[model samples]
Target: MIIKVRLIPTTGRNEVISRIGSVLRVKIKNKKVDDDAANAIMRTFLADFFNVHEESIIIVKGAKGKEKTVEVRDKSEEELRKIMDSIP
Candidate 1:
């Protein structure tokens, strides 16, 4: 499924802030070295956070921007809900 995220880069730590309605607010701890660096950090960090391969996380939009649209292949909304519900 596709989801939207508001990425806050160069934060003190990498974290998933909260679920603000439809958007997932995230913060990257790594310093903003460059646009590619920022995007790489996001991909790897999110991959670990969501327990998926880094290759599976596709930054469909806003690669160099703060607001990003990510696509996770094959997963459905219900599946995502189940996973999030399991996280505490």
Candidate 2:
């Protein structure tokens, strides 16, 4: 499944803030972290959230920007939707 994410950095914590339509708004702590570090953090958090390995998640676009397009392997859209729904 392909997921759109908007990352908000330096929020003092890593979490999924909200989801609007096909986009997920996420926040990550650390104002000094670079783009690569931020992306790695995002991948790790998402892997745990989706119950998948870190290698299964890839940032297909917007690697240098706040917005990113992620591709998730080994999961169906319906399954992802269910998992997303479980988030509070």
Candidate 3:
């Protein structure tokens, strides 16, 4: 499923709040907002949350910004939420 996420960098901790059904508000440490860091975080978040491979999570938008829209195919909203909630 595809989800819209408004990322807040420089946050105290990483978290995910569901907004509506397919949108999420994600907050992450600013130190992880850089290109390499973002990719690593994304991978870890998705893999741990959804129990999927890191390659499954795709950032469809905001690749260079704090806010992003991500596409994680073959997963339902419920599963996505569980995955997101698992993020630390």
Candidate 4:
């Protein structure tokens, strides 16, 4: 499934904050990290969150910006929503 995400980096912890329409708001915990590192962190977090392999997550766009377009392999939109809804 392809999803839109707004990544907030250098936060307290990696988490899915909320979903607003088509966009998923997420936060990453690594402070002082570069853009590449932040993207890696986002991929890893999403992989674990969606119970998919790290290679299954891809940043399709906005690699250097807060807003990103991601491709998640082997998951449907409905399944993704279920996982997102379970986030605290």
lDDT of 2: 0.85
Model 2 clashing-pair count: 0
- lDDT per model, in order? 0.76, 0.85, 0.67, 0.84
- Tens-digit per-residue lDDT, 20-64, candidate 2: 887888888846333888889999998988989999999999988
lDDT of 3 by residue, 2-86 (tens): 7676665655766664554555666666665647687567657755556677777888888876667777866677877676565
Task: Residues 4-87, candidate 1: write the lDDT tens digits.
Answer: 888776558887877776678778876562378888888898788777788989989888778889887545678776755554
Task: Write down the TM-score for model 4.
Answer: 0.84
Worst 10 residues of 2 by lDDT: 26-35
lDDT by residue (tens digit), candidate 4, 18-68: 888768888888663338888899999989988999999998988888899
What candidate 1 gets wrong by more than 4 Å, as runs, is 74-76, 85-88
Best by TM-score: 2
Relative to the unseen true structure, what is the C-alpha lDDT of residue 52 in candidate 2, on a scale of 0 to 100?
92
Clash totals for all candidate models: 0, 0, 1, 0
Candidate 3 clash pair list = 10-30
Candidate 3 Cα lDDT to native: 0.67
TM per candidate:
0.80, 0.88, 0.65, 0.84
Ranking by TM-score: 2, 4, 1, 3
Q: Residue 32, candidate 4: how far off, in angstroms?
A: 6.2
Stretch of 10 with least lDDT, candidate 1? 79-88
